[model samples]
Target: MTLSRDKAIIGAMEILSELIIIALLSIAGGVIAAMLPFAFPPAVISLFLLLLLLFLGIIKEDGLSSSSSFFLKYMAMFFVPSGVEIIEYADLLSSSWFHIILISAISMLITFFAAAKAVEITERLMQRRKAA
Candidate 1:
């Protein structure tokens, strides 16, 4: 019983530490966004910062694996607030539903085309490398 309790405490501490690391990165990102001239989302800045850290070997995937997994496990919960907001604005959305749908469709198609071309270019480059 004592051994299991110790393991549980260690596990909880690890998760807490991982969460602190993510929170610190988010705070740093907010500071950077505030210093920038243009408007940008702090969350996006945080993600980019995290990506840079990972690429530069300053942070390891293992360090974030548990926290990331925990987030993914409850990802749907994150969307709940958005869903509530949409419901709150249902009348406005209903009025502009067609225009909203049209824009969404057009943007989705453009994104798909862009992604397809990128993949094609990447494949060609890979093939060329193999041939060389």
Candidate 2:
């Protein structure tokens, strides 16, 4: 069964969860850095902490709402801004890098298959556990 429309969107406004927590952590780190007379960007500080949390397996995916996951799923598009730089220096990806492109394509295909298999295995395990 899927979540109802209202329930799915309820967490969207309650920033008390993931997004707000990351923002607060970043802000606190920024303040600490400023107080210590260190020279570090606030955004970078927050992102660093977020990565640390991720590494320690703190933030979870299951607790995230469908709407938040939707945004997170598409957020990779935000990298398009930096991706535009590839066109700014298009010559860097010319015919000389054809092998690189071919290898990258193959690697991406492999990664996709691997991730799909892993998810399938995980689902099977969960199903078996639930049945038991």
Candidate 3:
């Protein structure tokens, strides 16, 4: 009983620490974004900073694994607010429904084409490497 209790406590602490690290990085990203001359989303800046840290070996994947898993587990919850906002702005969305659908369709096609080309390039590169 004691052993299981201790393990639970340790696991909770680990998740807390991982969340703190992510929060600090996000705050730092916000500050950096504010200091920039051009308008840029702070969240994108945060993601880029996190990527840089990982690439530089300043942060290990294992360090964030728990928090990342937690986020993924509750990912649907994250979209709840967006859904609520859409409901709140249903009138505006209805008014622009046609434009929204057109833009969404165009963007989806562009994204699909880009992803297909990327995969083709990657496969060709891999095949060449195997041949070499």
lDDT of 1 by residue, 1-132 (tens): 999999999998989988998999999999999999999999999999999999999989988889999898998999898888898888999999999999999999999999999999999999999999
Candidate 1, clashing residue pairs? none
TM-score of each: 0.81, 0.39, 0.78
- Alpha-carbon runs more than 4 Å astray in model 2: 1-45, 48-81, 87-90
Model 1 ranges with Cα > 4 A deviation: 121-132
Mind giving the per-residue lDDT tens digits that candidate 3 earns over 1-132? Answer: 999999999989989889898999899989999999999999899999889999999999998999898898998999898888888888999899999999999999999999999999999999999999
Task: Estimate the Cα RMSD of every predicted model relative to the unseen true structure.
Answer: 2.5, 10.3, 3.0
Q: Write the per-residue lDDT of candidate 2 for residues 1-132, one digit (tens) a residue.
A: 357767667666554476677568868878867876668787777677766776777865454455367668899887889988888777877855888888999999999999999999999999999999
Clash totals in order: 0, 0, 0
Candidate 3 backbone collisions, by pair: none
The segments of candidate 3 whose C-alpha lies over 4 angstroms from its true place after superposition are 114-132
